[model samples]
Target: MSLLEVKNLKKYFATQKAVDDISLSIDKGNIFGLLGPNGAGKTTLIRMITGIFYPDSGEIFFDGKKFDPVNDVGLIGYMPEERGLYKKMKIGEQTLYLAQLKGMSRKDATAKVKDWFVRFGMESWWNKKVEDLSKGMSQKLQFVTTVLHNPKLIILDEPFSGLDPVNSNLIKDEIFRLAANGSTIIFSTHRMEQVEEICNRIALVNKGQKILDGTIKQVKQDFKENLYSIGADSLPDTTGNEPYEVIGKKEQNFIVRIKPNDKPNDVLQYLLQQGVSISSFNEILPSLNDIFIKLVEGTETARQFQNIKN
Candidate 1:
């Protein structure tokens, strides 16, 4: 069953559609990537999903029931891109306060805070004010509080923003650990490589509309370019008059985007037939970045083509 669902979600300003007919779903224990360029309605969608704002036209459901902004609030743990914490308050004190605000009892919050702080080697920070800690350290404290209540769903917007590489990996590892422990995560990020590595499914939104949505692998395959790169030692004068049109050539061999009738086996046989030594053979698969740009640009090309056809 889906842990979260949005249907025809729309949020608009007087003269702008902040989020326009956006819709997608996420299953339990999976990381869903919300991707788009800045000012592309990503933040607006996140706000609606986090219950920070109401949608003008749409429905949000959680666990198969209509989603209520209030009732479902506690069930979600949201860490905004902009970190917020009281800089003058003691670190431990602030964490405990926030945990309790999330509905955990004071006693439970304190105990949880202690366990987490010690595990994170932050036991000595119990009395240090937030202003005394480094940016990464401050983020750690805030992150601990965000998940201390063990929310069923965790929504993170650029969760690694201010951390160093080591600290960032620590947080990434924890994200995967949380999923392994059955926590569903909604990961919103602009880092395409990270999305490729961590996300099981992604929904790419542009200009407040969903342009693509599906499993990462399936989406990549759907956008495959049907091109192959062949690296070889040497070949015949393979040029203009050659049966295959060499579209591009790199250091080792030629890069060819073959016609539909050009079979891989036939290409290989022809290369060998020409006495060209084959060292490496590989097909080019579209990267998430490639797919993203293609989809976004393809929308415009498709519209232009349709206009011409009409």
Candidate 2:
């Protein structure tokens, strides 16, 4: 059974539809990416899932049961994009307070907070006030508080914000560790590389609607343009109109879009027959960033066209 499920969920504020008829299911131990452009329905959808807002229509299921905010509060951890730390509170005290509010006993919260501080190398910062920490340090403290209770499900929105590369890697490794230990995660971010690295599946929403949903591999394959990148000392000019189109070029490098049904081997044979020594050859698979720009821009263009027609 899926760890979380939403069925035709919808939410509206006045005349604006924040989330419209979105449905998604996340299985246990998987990192599911909730992705979209700015002002898209991603935030609204997340709020509904986390019980910060009730859907105007449809239903959500948690652990195979209908979600009841009061009863299911302890089962999930949510870290919003905005920092919620109390500036005047000491790090250790604040973490303990947050954990206890999440239903953990004070004793258990203190012990877990101490262990987390040691793990994150923040033992010395225990007595330091939140206002004294740098942006990155505060981000780390927020992360510790979010996970202190060891909730079965975790939702992180823009978790890497304000984190330096080293600290980002630290959190990335911890995310994997949590997932490996049977925790389900809902990751929301604008960083495509992070999603590509950690998410097994993703759902992209835009303008209050779901535009894309699938495993990362499936989505990429579906968006594949059959482009190939070749690196060599030099590339021969396709003066005779070779079977492939040269889409990009740089000094000693070329990206070609092979025709439908054309094999890479055939392209290689042609290059060899032309006396071209290949230094490198590989398919130019689209990155998540590439796909995101394409889909979002395409949707916007279509919307503009529709408005013109109307």
Q: Which predicted model would earn the best TM-score? A: 2
**Predicted candidate 2 versus true structure: per-residue lDDT over 1-310, tens digit per residue:** 6999999999877646778799999999999999998878788898888899999999999999999888687788999986579999988888888998899999999899989989999999988999999999999989998888999899999999999999999999999999999999999999999999999999999888899999999999999999988998777776755667788886678989987767888889889988999999988779999999998885553222112110
Report lDDT per candidate.
0.84, 0.89
User: TM-score of the candidate numbered 2?
Assistant: 0.92
Cα lDDT, model 2, residue 226: 90
Q: What lDDT tens digits, residue by residue, belong to model 1 across residues 55-168?
A: 989999987889988878878899988778998998878998888778889999889999988878899999999899888888887778878888888989888878998988
Each candidate: RMSD: 4.8, 3.4
Task: Give the Cα error of residue 73 in candidate 1, in Å.
Answer: 1.2
Positional deviation of residue 261's Cα in model 2 after best superposition, in angstroms = 3.3
Question: TM-scores of all models?
Answer: 0.90, 0.92
Query: What's the lDDT for residue 146 in model 2?
Result: 87
